[model samples]
Target: MKNLLVTGYRMNELNIFDQKNKAIVYIKRAIAGRLAPLAEEGLEWVLTPGQFGVDLWACETVIDLKRERFPQLKLGIVTAYANPEEKWKEDKQNYYRNILKDADYYGAVSNRPYEGAWQFKARDELLFRKTDGILLFYDEEMGEASPKFVKERALKLADEEGYRYIAIGADEVQSMADEERLSSFD
Candidate 1:
Protein backbone atom coordinates (compact mmCIF):
# COMPACT_ATOMS: atom_id res chain seq x y z
CA MET A 1 0.00 0.00 0.00
CA LYS A 2 2.52 2.58 -1.10
CA ASN A 3 1.59 6.25 -1.36
CA LEU A 4 2.63 8.50 -4.27
CA LEU A 5 2.78 12.25 -4.80
CA VAL A 6 2.07 14.11 -8.07
CA THR A 7 3.50 17.51 -9.11
CA GLY A 8 3.68 19.56 -12.30
CA TYR A 9 2.95 22.83 -14.13
CA ARG A 10 -0.35 24.61 -13.80
CA MET A 11 -2.75 25.07 -16.72
CA ASN A 12 -1.49 28.52 -17.62
CA GLU A 13 2.05 27.31 -17.77
CA LEU A 14 1.09 24.31 -19.86
CA ASN A 15 -1.05 26.49 -22.16
CA ILE A 16 -3.98 24.14 -21.68
CA PHE A 17 -7.19 25.72 -22.97
CA ASP A 18 -10.30 24.87 -21.02
CA GLN A 19 -9.40 21.18 -20.52
CA LYS A 20 -9.99 20.61 -24.23
CA ASN A 21 -6.44 20.71 -25.48
CA LYS A 22 -5.65 17.60 -27.47
CA ALA A 23 -2.18 17.48 -25.98
CA ILE A 24 -3.52 17.68 -22.47
CA VAL A 25 -5.98 14.85 -23.15
CA TYR A 26 -3.14 12.72 -24.47
CA ILE A 27 -0.92 13.60 -21.55
CA LYS A 28 -3.59 12.59 -19.08
CA ARG A 29 -4.13 9.31 -20.88
CA ALA A 30 -0.40 8.68 -20.92
CA ILE A 31 -0.20 9.40 -17.21
CA ALA A 32 -3.15 7.10 -16.52
CA GLY A 33 -1.51 4.39 -18.59
CA ARG A 34 1.70 4.76 -16.60
CA LEU A 35 -0.17 4.54 -13.31
CA ALA A 36 -1.75 1.21 -14.20
CA PRO A 37 1.60 -0.55 -13.96
CA LEU A 38 2.39 1.19 -10.69
CA ALA A 39 -0.99 0.30 -9.25
CA GLU A 40 -0.26 -3.34 -10.08
CA GLU A 41 3.13 -2.93 -8.43
CA GLY A 42 1.64 -1.90 -5.05
CA LEU A 43 0.52 1.73 -5.21
CA GLU A 44 -2.66 2.32 -3.25
CA TRP A 45 -2.86 6.03 -2.58
CA VAL A 46 -2.21 9.11 -4.73
CA LEU A 47 -1.69 12.54 -3.21
CA THR A 48 -2.25 15.60 -5.36
CA PRO A 49 -1.94 19.28 -4.51
CA GLY A 50 -5.26 20.01 -6.26
CA GLN A 51 -3.60 22.52 -8.55
CA PHE A 52 -4.61 23.01 -12.16
CA GLY A 53 -3.04 21.16 -15.11
CA VAL A 54 -0.98 18.14 -14.23
CA ASP A 55 -2.00 17.78 -10.62
CA LEU A 56 -5.72 17.99 -11.30
CA TRP A 57 -5.43 15.80 -14.37
CA ALA A 58 -3.47 13.22 -12.39
CA CYS A 59 -6.09 13.25 -9.65
CA GLU A 60 -8.86 12.69 -12.19
CA THR A 61 -6.87 9.91 -13.81
CA VAL A 62 -6.31 8.24 -10.44
CA ILE A 63 -10.02 8.46 -9.66
CA ASP A 64 -10.87 6.84 -12.98
CA LEU A 65 -8.27 4.16 -12.45
CA LYS A 66 -9.61 3.45 -9.00
CA ARG A 67 -13.13 3.02 -10.35
CA GLU A 68 -12.13 0.86 -13.31
CA ARG A 69 -9.26 -1.23 -12.01
CA PHE A 70 -7.78 -0.44 -8.61
CA PRO A 71 -10.72 -0.68 -6.29
CA GLN A 72 -8.53 -0.14 -3.26
CA LEU A 73 -6.81 2.98 -4.58
CA LYS A 74 -7.51 6.30 -2.89
CA LEU A 75 -6.92 10.00 -3.57
CA GLY A 76 -5.81 12.72 -1.18
CA ILE A 77 -5.82 16.42 -2.04
CA VAL A 78 -3.34 18.53 -0.12
CA THR A 79 -3.61 22.28 -0.27
CA ALA A 80 -0.90 24.83 0.44
CA TYR A 81 -3.17 26.76 2.74
CA ALA A 82 -6.72 27.07 3.93
CA ASN A 83 -8.76 28.20 0.90
CA PRO A 84 -5.88 27.68 -1.47
CA GLU A 85 -8.25 28.26 -4.35
CA GLU A 86 -9.16 31.70 -3.07
CA LYS A 87 -7.28 33.42 -5.84
CA TRP A 88 -8.31 31.13 -8.64
CA LYS A 89 -10.98 32.05 -11.18
CA GLU A 90 -14.53 31.02 -10.37
CA ASP A 91 -14.62 28.13 -12.80
CA LYS A 92 -11.27 26.88 -11.68
CA GLN A 93 -12.23 27.20 -8.04
CA ASN A 94 -15.42 25.25 -8.67
CA TYR A 95 -13.51 22.50 -10.41
CA TYR A 96 -11.00 22.33 -7.58
CA ARG A 97 -13.76 22.14 -5.01
CA ASN A 98 -15.48 19.37 -6.90
CA ILE A 99 -12.33 17.30 -6.95
CA LEU A 100 -11.71 17.93 -3.27
CA LYS A 101 -15.21 16.80 -2.51
CA ASP A 102 -14.60 13.53 -4.31
CA ALA A 103 -11.21 12.87 -2.73
CA ASP A 104 -10.93 10.21 -0.06
CA TYR A 105 -9.03 12.73 2.09
CA TYR A 106 -8.31 16.45 1.94
CA GLY A 107 -6.20 18.72 4.11
CA ALA A 108 -4.30 21.95 4.06
CA VAL A 109 -0.63 21.94 4.89
CA SER A 110 -1.01 25.41 6.37
CA ASN A 111 -4.16 25.96 8.36
CA ARG A 112 -3.95 29.72 7.78
CA PRO A 113 -4.15 31.78 4.62
CA TYR A 114 -1.25 31.76 2.19
CA GLU A 115 1.44 34.16 3.32
CA GLY A 116 4.46 33.83 1.09
CA ALA A 117 6.81 31.51 -0.79
CA TRP A 118 7.66 29.70 2.41
CA GLN A 119 4.12 28.31 2.58
CA PHE A 120 4.49 26.72 -0.85
CA LYS A 121 7.89 25.30 0.06
CA ALA A 122 6.51 23.97 3.31
CA ARG A 123 3.61 22.34 1.48
CA ASP A 124 6.02 20.71 -0.95
CA GLU A 125 8.14 19.48 1.94
CA LEU A 126 5.08 18.06 3.65
CA LEU A 127 4.03 16.26 0.47
CA PHE A 128 7.53 14.87 0.04
CA ARG A 129 7.59 13.69 3.62
CA LYS A 130 4.32 11.80 3.29
CA THR A 131 4.76 9.89 0.05
CA ASP A 132 6.91 6.88 -0.86
CA GLY A 133 7.18 7.84 -4.53
CA ILE A 134 6.71 10.83 -6.86
CA LEU A 135 5.35 11.36 -10.36
CA LEU A 136 6.51 14.62 -11.98
CA PHE A 137 5.28 16.24 -15.18
CA TYR A 138 7.72 18.97 -16.07
CA ASP A 139 9.28 20.98 -18.85
CA GLU A 140 12.65 22.57 -18.23
CA GLU A 141 12.00 25.27 -20.82
CA MET A 142 8.99 26.72 -19.04
CA GLY A 143 11.00 29.09 -16.87
CA GLU A 144 8.13 31.04 -15.36
CA ALA A 145 7.36 29.33 -12.06
CA SER A 146 8.65 26.24 -13.79
CA PRO A 147 7.53 22.77 -12.77
CA LYS A 148 11.16 21.80 -13.30
CA PHE A 149 12.03 23.73 -10.15
CA VAL A 150 9.56 21.78 -8.06
CA LYS A 151 10.49 18.51 -9.72
CA GLU A 152 14.14 19.09 -8.96
CA ARG A 153 13.44 19.87 -5.33
CA ALA A 154 11.19 16.82 -5.01
CA LEU A 155 13.75 14.60 -6.72
CA LYS A 156 16.46 15.85 -4.37
CA LEU A 157 14.27 15.08 -1.39
CA ALA A 158 13.34 11.69 -2.82
CA ASP A 159 17.02 10.86 -3.20
CA GLU A 160 17.67 11.89 0.38
CA GLU A 161 14.73 9.85 1.60
CA GLY A 162 15.37 6.89 -0.73
CA TYR A 163 12.01 7.15 -2.45
CA ARG A 164 11.23 6.17 -6.01
CA TYR A 165 10.43 8.87 -8.61
CA ILE A 166 9.34 9.07 -12.24
CA ALA A 167 9.30 12.16 -14.47
CA ILE A 168 7.49 12.77 -17.78
CA GLY A 169 8.84 15.68 -19.75
CA ALA A 170 7.25 17.96 -22.35
CA ASP A 171 8.90 16.21 -25.28
CA GLU A 172 7.68 12.83 -24.14
CA VAL A 173 4.18 14.24 -23.72
CA GLN A 174 4.26 15.63 -27.23
CA SER A 175 5.46 12.31 -28.58
CA MET A 176 2.63 10.57 -26.81
CA ALA A 177 0.07 12.99 -28.21
CA ASP A 178 1.46 12.47 -31.69
CA GLU A 179 1.23 8.71 -31.29
CA GLU A 180 -2.34 9.04 -30.09
CA ARG A 181 -3.25 11.13 -33.10
CA LEU A 182 -1.64 8.65 -35.46
CA SER A 183 -3.32 5.69 -33.85
CA SER A 184 -6.69 7.38 -33.99
CA PHE A 185 -6.53 7.38 -37.77
CA ASP A 186 -6.24 3.60 -37.86
Candidate 2:
Protein backbone atom coordinates (compact mmCIF):
# COMPACT_ATOMS: atom_id res chain seq x y z
CA MET A 1 0.00 0.00 0.00
CA LYS A 2 1.04 3.58 -0.63
CA ASN A 3 0.84 6.61 1.64
CA LEU A 4 -1.06 9.75 0.67
CA LEU A 5 -1.95 13.18 1.92
CA VAL A 6 -5.23 15.05 1.35
CA THR A 7 -5.53 18.75 1.97
CA GLY A 8 -8.50 21.10 2.28
CA TYR A 9 -9.58 24.47 3.70
CA ARG A 10 -8.31 25.38 7.16
CA MET A 11 -8.22 28.37 9.47
CA ASN A 12 -4.94 28.48 11.36
CA GLU A 13 -5.76 31.14 13.91
CA LEU A 14 -6.88 30.06 17.33
CA ASN A 15 -9.13 33.08 17.39
CA ILE A 16 -11.36 31.51 14.74
CA PHE A 17 -12.83 29.34 17.47
CA ASP A 18 -12.11 31.69 20.41
CA GLN A 19 -9.95 29.06 22.07
CA LYS A 20 -6.76 27.14 21.45
CA ASN A 21 -8.56 23.91 22.25
CA LYS A 22 -11.11 24.65 19.58
CA ALA A 23 -8.37 25.13 17.03
CA ILE A 24 -6.90 21.83 18.02
CA VAL A 25 -10.25 20.17 17.66
CA TYR A 26 -10.65 21.49 14.15
CA ILE A 27 -7.21 20.26 13.20
CA LYS A 28 -7.87 16.91 14.80
CA ARG A 29 -10.99 16.46 12.73
CA ALA A 30 -9.11 17.29 9.57
CA ILE A 31 -6.38 14.82 10.48
CA ALA A 32 -8.92 12.11 11.18
CA GLY A 33 -10.63 12.60 7.82
CA ARG A 34 -7.36 12.02 5.93
CA LEU A 35 -6.20 9.15 8.08
CA ALA A 36 -9.41 7.14 8.22
CA PRO A 37 -9.19 5.60 4.76
CA LEU A 38 -5.43 5.17 4.89
CA ALA A 39 -5.75 3.33 8.16
CA GLU A 40 -8.20 0.89 6.63
CA GLU A 41 -5.94 0.32 3.65
CA GLY A 42 -2.93 -0.17 5.91
CA LEU A 43 -1.42 2.78 4.08
CA GLU A 44 -0.15 5.91 5.77
CA TRP A 45 -1.71 9.35 5.29
CA VAL A 46 -0.05 12.57 6.30
CA LEU A 47 -2.01 15.79 6.73
CA THR A 48 -0.74 19.31 6.34
CA PRO A 49 -2.42 22.69 6.04
CA GLY A 50 -3.95 23.53 2.68
CA GLN A 51 -2.54 26.46 0.71
CA PHE A 52 -5.35 28.76 1.86
CA GLY A 53 -4.33 28.50 5.53
CA VAL A 54 -0.73 27.65 6.18
CA ASP A 55 -0.95 28.33 9.89
CA LEU A 56 2.54 28.01 11.26
CA TRP A 57 1.46 26.83 14.68
CA ALA A 58 -1.27 24.57 13.34
CA CYS A 59 1.12 23.12 10.80
CA GLU A 60 3.65 22.34 13.51
CA THR A 61 1.00 20.68 15.62
CA VAL A 62 -0.07 18.46 12.73
CA ILE A 63 3.52 17.48 11.96
CA ASP A 64 4.22 16.76 15.61
CA LEU A 65 1.12 14.65 15.96
CA LYS A 66 1.96 12.67 12.82
CA ARG A 67 5.49 12.01 14.00
CA GLU A 68 4.22 10.91 17.37
CA ARG A 69 1.28 8.83 16.20
CA PHE A 70 2.46 7.50 12.87
CA PRO A 71 6.13 8.18 12.43
CA GLN A 72 6.40 6.20 9.23
CA LEU A 73 3.59 7.67 7.17
CA LYS A 74 4.12 9.15 3.73
CA LEU A 75 3.55 12.87 3.26
CA GLY A 76 1.77 15.08 0.70
CA ILE A 77 0.38 18.61 0.56
CA VAL A 78 -3.08 19.83 -0.51
CA THR A 79 -3.98 23.00 -2.40
CA ALA A 80 -7.20 24.97 -1.93
CA TYR A 81 -9.06 27.65 -3.92
CA ALA A 82 -7.21 26.64 -7.07
CA ASN A 83 -7.64 29.96 -8.76
CA PRO A 84 -6.18 33.30 -7.82
CA GLU A 85 -8.73 36.09 -8.25
CA GLU A 86 -7.79 38.56 -5.56
CA LYS A 87 -4.40 40.17 -5.63
CA TRP A 88 -4.83 41.55 -2.13
CA LYS A 89 -5.61 38.17 -0.71
CA GLU A 90 -2.88 35.96 0.67
CA ASP A 91 -2.02 33.14 -1.71
CA LYS A 92 -0.48 29.88 -0.59
CA GLN A 93 1.90 30.07 -3.55
CA ASN A 94 4.87 30.23 -1.26
CA TYR A 95 3.63 27.46 0.96
CA TYR A 96 2.68 25.28 -1.98
CA ARG A 97 5.98 26.05 -3.65
CA ASN A 98 7.89 24.80 -0.66
CA ILE A 99 5.89 21.59 -0.64
CA LEU A 100 6.37 21.00 -4.36
CA LYS A 101 10.09 21.60 -4.04
CA ASP A 102 10.47 19.37 -1.00
CA ALA A 103 7.60 16.90 -0.68
CA ASP A 104 7.34 13.51 -2.36
CA TYR A 105 4.02 14.47 -4.00
CA TYR A 106 1.26 17.11 -3.97
CA GLY A 107 -2.45 17.49 -4.86
CA ALA A 108 -4.56 20.52 -5.65
CA VAL A 109 -8.26 20.39 -4.71
CA SER A 110 -10.41 22.70 -6.75
CA ASN A 111 -13.38 22.90 -9.08
CA ARG A 112 -11.03 22.36 -12.09
CA PRO A 113 -7.88 20.31 -12.50
CA TYR A 114 -4.32 21.56 -13.08
CA GLU A 115 -1.31 19.99 -14.82
CA GLY A 116 1.36 19.57 -12.19
CA ALA A 117 1.53 19.85 -8.38
CA TRP A 118 4.29 22.37 -8.95
CA GLN A 119 1.81 24.44 -10.97
CA PHE A 120 0.01 25.20 -7.72
CA LYS A 121 3.08 27.06 -6.60
CA ALA A 122 4.01 28.20 -10.13
CA ARG A 123 7.62 27.66 -9.19
CA ASP A 124 10.09 25.59 -11.17
CA GLU A 125 7.28 24.04 -13.16
CA LEU A 126 6.38 27.32 -14.84
CA LEU A 127 9.98 28.00 -15.75
CA PHE A 128 10.20 24.45 -16.96
CA ARG A 129 7.17 25.09 -19.16
CA LYS A 130 9.11 27.86 -20.91
CA THR A 131 5.84 29.69 -21.20
CA ASP A 132 6.10 32.95 -23.12
CA GLY A 133 3.68 34.42 -20.60
CA ILE A 134 0.91 33.36 -18.24
CA LEU A 135 -2.45 34.98 -18.81
CA LEU A 136 -4.72 35.30 -15.82
CA PHE A 137 -8.25 36.22 -16.85
CA TYR A 138 -11.26 36.39 -14.55
CA ASP A 139 -13.91 34.48 -16.44
CA GLU A 140 -15.57 33.34 -13.17
CA GLU A 141 -17.16 30.65 -15.28
CA MET A 142 -14.34 28.32 -16.36
CA GLY A 143 -14.65 24.56 -15.79
CA GLU A 144 -12.60 22.84 -13.07
CA ALA A 145 -11.24 19.35 -12.48
CA SER A 146 -9.07 17.24 -10.18
CA PRO A 147 -5.52 18.45 -9.56
CA LYS A 148 -4.10 14.98 -9.03
CA PHE A 149 -5.36 13.51 -12.27
CA VAL A 150 -4.54 16.66 -14.20
CA LYS A 151 -0.98 16.66 -12.95
CA GLU A 152 -0.56 13.03 -13.83
CA ARG A 153 -1.69 13.59 -17.38
CA ALA A 154 0.52 16.62 -17.73
CA LEU A 155 3.51 14.49 -16.82
CA LYS A 156 2.54 11.91 -19.41
CA LEU A 157 2.21 14.55 -22.09
CA ALA A 158 5.57 15.90 -21.10
CA ASP A 159 7.03 12.48 -21.74
CA GLU A 160 5.19 12.01 -25.01
CA GLU A 161 5.76 15.48 -26.39
CA GLY A 162 9.37 15.25 -25.32
CA TYR A 163 8.51 18.35 -23.40
CA ARG A 164 10.23 18.30 -20.08
CA TYR A 165 8.32 21.46 -19.38
CA ILE A 166 4.63 21.83 -20.47
CA ALA A 167 2.45 20.02 -22.96
CA ILE A 168 -1.12 19.03 -23.85
CA GLY A 169 -2.94 21.56 -21.68
CA ALA A 170 -6.34 20.26 -22.78
CA ASP A 171 -5.48 16.58 -22.73
CA GLU A 172 -3.93 16.84 -19.30
CA VAL A 173 -7.03 18.59 -18.04
CA GLN A 174 -9.09 15.78 -19.51
CA SER A 175 -6.92 13.13 -17.85
CA MET A 176 -7.39 14.78 -14.50
CA ALA A 177 -11.16 14.69 -14.91
CA ASP A 178 -10.83 11.06 -15.93
CA GLU A 179 -8.67 10.25 -12.89
CA GLU A 180 -5.70 8.97 -14.86
CA ARG A 181 -2.80 10.55 -12.94
CA LEU A 182 -1.33 9.00 -9.80
CA SER A 183 1.91 10.70 -8.76
CA SER A 184 1.80 9.13 -5.32
CA PHE A 185 1.95 5.73 -6.96
CA ASP A 186 5.14 6.78 -8.69
Candidate 3:
Protein backbone atom coordinates (compact mmCIF):
# COMPACT_ATOMS: atom_id res chain seq x y z
CA MET A 1 0.00 0.00 0.00
CA LYS A 2 1.19 3.52 -0.76
CA ASN A 3 -0.60 5.34 2.06
CA LEU A 4 -1.12 3.84 5.50
CA LEU A 5 -3.01 5.04 8.55
CA VAL A 6 -1.22 4.30 11.84
CA THR A 7 -3.40 4.65 14.92
CA GLY A 8 -3.90 3.20 18.38
CA TYR A 9 -4.58 3.87 22.07
CA ARG A 10 -4.02 7.20 23.77
CA MET A 11 -1.50 7.62 26.58
CA ASN A 12 -4.17 7.44 29.24
CA GLU A 13 -5.63 4.35 27.68
CA LEU A 14 -2.22 2.73 27.77
CA ASN A 15 -1.59 4.06 31.30
CA ILE A 16 1.64 5.58 30.10
CA PHE A 17 1.64 9.11 31.44
CA ASP A 18 5.34 9.86 31.18
CA GLN A 19 6.79 10.35 27.75
CA LYS A 20 10.23 9.00 28.68
CA ASN A 21 8.91 5.62 29.76
CA LYS A 22 11.44 3.07 28.44
CA ALA A 23 8.58 0.98 27.10
CA ILE A 24 8.18 3.48 24.27
CA VAL A 25 11.33 2.18 22.64
CA TYR A 26 9.80 -1.26 22.22
CA ILE A 27 6.65 0.22 20.79
CA LYS A 28 8.57 2.15 18.18
CA ARG A 29 10.56 -0.92 17.23
CA ALA A 30 7.40 -2.93 16.69
CA ILE A 31 5.96 -0.18 14.52
CA ALA A 32 9.16 0.00 12.48
CA GLY A 33 9.21 -3.76 11.98
CA ARG A 34 5.64 -3.66 10.68
CA LEU A 35 6.32 -0.73 8.38
CA ALA A 36 9.68 -1.75 6.92
CA PRO A 37 8.22 -4.44 4.67
CA LEU A 38 5.41 -2.15 3.67
CA ALA A 39 7.93 0.53 2.78
CA GLU A 40 9.83 -1.93 0.63
CA GLU A 41 6.51 -2.73 -1.02
CA GLY A 42 5.99 0.97 -1.85
CA LEU A 43 4.51 2.41 1.35
CA GLU A 44 5.09 6.10 0.81
CA TRP A 45 3.25 7.83 3.62
CA VAL A 46 2.13 7.12 7.20
CA LEU A 47 -0.95 9.01 8.31
CA THR A 48 -1.87 9.19 11.99
CA PRO A 49 -4.67 10.78 13.99
CA GLY A 50 -2.06 12.60 16.14
CA GLN A 51 -3.06 11.13 19.50
CA PHE A 52 -0.44 11.18 22.26
CA GLY A 53 0.44 7.49 22.30
CA VAL A 54 0.88 5.18 19.36
CA ASP A 55 -0.03 7.86 16.88
CA LEU A 56 2.87 10.12 17.87
CA TRP A 57 5.13 7.13 18.33
CA ALA A 58 4.29 6.04 14.81
CA CYS A 59 5.25 9.49 13.58
CA GLU A 60 8.62 9.18 15.26
CA THR A 61 9.08 5.72 13.82
CA VAL A 62 8.31 6.94 10.31
CA ILE A 63 10.70 9.85 10.77
CA ASP A 64 13.45 7.53 11.96
CA LEU A 65 12.87 5.18 9.03
CA LYS A 66 12.98 8.11 6.62
CA ARG A 67 16.27 9.34 8.04
CA GLU A 68 18.02 5.99 8.46
CA ARG A 69 16.60 3.70 5.77
CA PHE A 70 13.57 4.56 3.72
CA PRO A 71 14.02 8.15 2.61
CA GLN A 72 10.76 8.08 0.70
CA LEU A 73 8.57 7.42 3.75
CA LYS A 74 6.73 10.51 4.96
CA LEU A 75 4.63 11.33 8.05
CA GLY A 76 1.30 13.08 7.98
CA ILE A 77 -0.56 14.26 11.10
CA VAL A 78 -4.26 14.54 10.43
CA THR A 79 -6.32 15.15 13.53
CA ALA A 80 -10.01 14.55 13.97
CA TYR A 81 -10.46 18.23 14.62
CA ALA A 82 -8.45 21.37 15.26
CA ASN A 83 -6.87 21.96 18.69
CA PRO A 84 -6.37 18.32 19.43
CA GLU A 85 -4.02 19.26 22.25
CA GLU A 86 -6.16 21.96 23.74
CA LYS A 87 -7.08 19.97 26.81
CA TRP A 88 -3.71 18.29 27.14
CA LYS A 89 -1.13 19.14 29.76
CA GLU A 90 1.67 21.57 28.89
CA ASP A 91 4.28 18.95 28.13
CA LYS A 92 1.89 16.87 26.10
CA GLN A 93 0.82 19.89 24.09
CA ASN A 94 4.42 20.76 23.37
CA TYR A 95 5.09 17.23 22.21
CA TYR A 96 2.15 17.36 19.83
CA ARG A 97 3.33 20.70 18.49
CA ASN A 98 6.79 19.32 17.78
CA ILE A 99 5.31 16.32 16.00
CA LEU A 100 3.26 18.66 13.84
CA LYS A 101 6.34 20.73 13.11
CA ASP A 102 8.11 17.67 11.73
CA ALA A 103 5.11 16.43 9.77
CA ASP A 104 5.21 16.49 5.98
CA TYR A 105 1.53 17.43 6.03
CA TYR A 106 -0.92 18.34 8.82
CA GLY A 107 -4.62 19.04 8.83
CA ALA A 108 -7.80 18.49 10.74
CA VAL A 109 -10.59 16.33 9.39
CA SER A 110 -13.03 18.75 10.87
CA ASN A 111 -12.00 22.36 10.46
CA ARG A 112 -13.55 23.27 13.77
CA PRO A 113 -12.31 22.16 17.14
CA TYR A 114 -13.79 18.98 18.63
CA GLU A 115 -17.50 19.21 19.12
CA GLY A 116 -18.50 15.59 19.50
CA ALA A 117 -17.70 12.02 18.45
CA TRP A 118 -18.90 12.83 14.98
CA GLN A 119 -15.61 14.52 14.24
CA PHE A 120 -13.73 11.35 15.03
CA LYS A 121 -15.92 9.34 12.69
CA ALA A 122 -15.39 11.94 10.00
CA ARG A 123 -11.66 11.60 10.52
CA ASP A 124 -11.83 7.84 10.12
CA GLU A 125 -13.86 8.23 6.98
CA LEU A 126 -11.50 10.78 5.49
CA LEU A 127 -8.40 8.83 6.40
CA PHE A 128 -9.82 5.55 5.12
CA ARG A 129 -10.60 7.22 1.83
CA LYS A 130 -7.08 8.60 1.52
CA THR A 131 -5.15 5.56 2.70
CA ASP A 132 -4.79 2.15 1.10
CA GLY A 133 -4.32 0.36 4.42
CA ILE A 134 -4.30 0.75 8.19
CA LEU A 135 -1.73 -0.32 10.77
CA LEU A 136 -3.52 -0.36 14.09
CA PHE A 137 -1.59 -0.84 17.34
CA TYR A 138 -4.49 -2.19 19.28
CA ASP A 139 -5.59 -5.31 21.11
CA GLU A 140 -9.08 -6.72 21.05
CA GLU A 141 -8.81 -7.46 24.75
CA MET A 142 -8.75 -3.78 25.44
CA GLY A 143 -12.46 -3.93 24.99
CA GLU A 144 -13.33 -0.36 25.89
CA ALA A 145 -10.21 1.24 24.50
CA SER A 146 -10.55 4.11 22.06
CA PRO A 147 -8.73 2.14 19.40
CA LYS A 148 -11.57 -0.38 19.48
CA PHE A 149 -13.76 2.07 17.64
CA VAL A 150 -11.20 2.53 14.93
CA LYS A 151 -10.63 -1.21 14.82
CA GLU A 152 -14.31 -1.85 14.29
CA ARG A 153 -14.48 0.61 11.44
CA ALA A 154 -11.44 -0.94 9.82
CA LEU A 155 -12.87 -4.44 10.09
CA LYS A 156 -16.10 -3.38 8.46
CA LEU A 157 -14.33 -1.77 5.56
CA ALA A 158 -11.74 -4.49 5.15
CA ASP A 159 -14.21 -7.14 3.98
CA GLU A 160 -16.66 -4.91 2.20
CA GLU A 161 -14.21 -2.67 0.37
CA GLY A 162 -11.12 -4.89 0.25
CA TYR A 163 -9.14 -2.47 2.39
CA ARG A 164 -6.10 -3.70 4.30
CA TYR A 165 -5.99 -3.58 8.09
CA ILE A 166 -3.05 -4.77 10.16
CA ALA A 167 -3.11 -4.93 13.96
CA ILE A 168 0.01 -5.02 16.14
CA GLY A 169 -1.02 -6.17 19.58
CA ALA A 170 0.55 -6.78 22.99
CA ASP A 171 2.03 -10.06 21.83
CA GLU A 172 3.72 -8.43 18.90
CA VAL A 173 5.11 -5.65 21.06
CA GLN A 174 6.41 -8.11 23.64
CA SER A 175 8.11 -10.03 20.85
CA MET A 176 9.68 -6.83 19.60
CA ALA A 177 11.05 -6.12 23.05
CA ASP A 178 12.43 -9.62 23.26
CA GLU A 179 14.08 -9.23 19.89
CA GLU A 180 15.63 -5.94 20.91
CA ARG A 181 17.02 -7.42 24.12
CA LEU A 182 18.47 -10.41 22.27
CA SER A 183 20.02 -8.21 19.59
CA SER A 184 21.72 -6.00 22.16
CA PHE A 185 24.06 -8.81 23.13
CA ASP A 186 25.39 -9.08 19.56
Question: What are the candidates' C-alpha RMSDs?
Answer: 1.8, 14.6, 1.7
Predicted structure 1: lDDT: 0.83
| TM agreement with the true structure for every prediction | 0.91, 0.32, 0.92
**lDDT per model, in order?**
0.83, 0.38, 0.89
Best by lDDT: 3
Against the true structure, candidate 1 reaches a TM-score of: 0.91
Clashing pairs in 2: 111-144, 112-144, 112-145, 113-145, 115-151, 149-176, 150-176
Instruction: Report how far off residue 114 is in candidate 2 (Å).
Output: 14
lDDT for each residue of candidate 3 in 52-125, tens digit (9 for 90 to 100): 89999999999889999999888998888998899988988888888788799999988897799999888888
Candidate 1 structure quality by residue, lDDT tens digits, 1-186 = 399898788888876769777777777887887789989998888998888888999988888898899988899989888998888889988888888877999998889998888878888888888898788887667565657677777768767877877887778888887887899999
Candidate with the greatest TM-score versus the true structure: 3
Q: Tell me which of candidates 1 and 3 scores higher on TM-score.
A: 3
Q: After superposition, how far is residue 133 of candidate 2 from its true place, in Å?
A: 33
